[model samples]
Target: MADDSLFAQGMATRRAVLGDAHVDNATARTTEFDADFQTFITEGAWGSVWSRPGLSKRERSLVTLALLAGLGHEEEFAMHVRATLNTGATPADIKEALLHVAVYAGVPAANSAFKIAKQELAKRQEAAQ
Candidate 1:
């Protein structure tokens, strides 16, 4: 698909996964320097990869969580943990993925990821209540 089409598709997917509020907040904070970076992630990551039909969003979410946890991207991991609500990734799925992280990514990474995930999940649950 063309870049424009990819960007459009990516924006839609991003919104669906991250929600309008988060997207809008990011958009609002976009600066001249980071504008291209934002577009790159939208077109490349969300459009080209996420838009693919090979895996369900739930599966993608799990993979993303594991990768982020493995890389020790605590903030992004927490954000994706919250995005699981829209991605249909359950707490069980997240636990399994974190277990994989522990085995492959190291106990320290998984330990930190687990802590962040618990905090984010608790915030979501509290909000729902």
Candidate 2:
């Protein structure tokens, strides 16, 4: 069984970072096939790691975005790019992180990530204004 306290903590942090609308949609879309996977991520990723005190949310956001990009996880990269705004990471910081990905991860991955970031950032700007 999942740790209740850790699960609660993870859910709270996930909602805060990803936003209620996004999290709600994600939860709603969870299927029987992936339910266990979702639970594991919440209990392990969000609760065990992301909730730790070692890194600031902003730092974690940067690392997450870069790692997702490096792995060619475009959907996750886009989601995190949006989440970065909530974590106090600026567009410039994201761009810089992606630049680092270009050198370390590969230019193709960074290039794709930049496109997704630009699109997501533009959407956010439009929503705000």
Candidate 3:
């Protein structure tokens, strides 16, 4: 975004959803060539859209999971699933979302997403203990 304030808002929203640790890792790994891309998503996706008031972050998390699963973005889907820690998406919500993916996105996409989601969820649960 052209406006620094808007970009800052995006950064905050992104961090809120993705968690500071994940965002920090992404930032640390950003190269000069990809820095522009980072800024664009931070401003456009996280800042402008995610910062909007229309949808709660929890609902956004469900929609994001469905979109990512349907798009076959397994990695991004898994990342967003991890983001559920902050987004308040329950395991049941993820299961329901994946069921939607199975119907619309096909069973294969849902299968992969379920595998990743289960693994990530297990990791989080184990870490919590």
lDDT of each: 0.94, 0.93, 0.93
Error of 1 at 129 (Å): 1.0
Ranking by TM-score: 1, 2, 3
Which model scores highest in TM-score? 1
TM, every model: 0.97, 0.96, 0.96
- After superposition, the stretches of candidate 1 with alpha carbons farther than 4 Å from their true spots are none
Q: Candidate 3: lDDT of 90?
A: 96
lDDT of 3 by residue, 19-76 (tens): 9999999999999899889999988999899999999999999999999998999889
Tens-digit lDDT track for model 1 on 5-65? 9999999999988889999999999998999999999999999898899999999999999
Cand. 3 Cα-lDDT: 0.93
Model 3 stretches astray by more than 4 angstroms: none
Clash count (model 1, backbone only): 0
Inter-residue clash pairs, candidate 3: 10-47
* Sliding window of 10 residues with minimal summed lDDT for model 2: 81-90
Rank the candidate models, highest lDDT first.
1, 3, 2
The alpha-carbon RMSD values of the candidates against the true structure, listed in the order shown, are 1.5, 0.9, 1.1
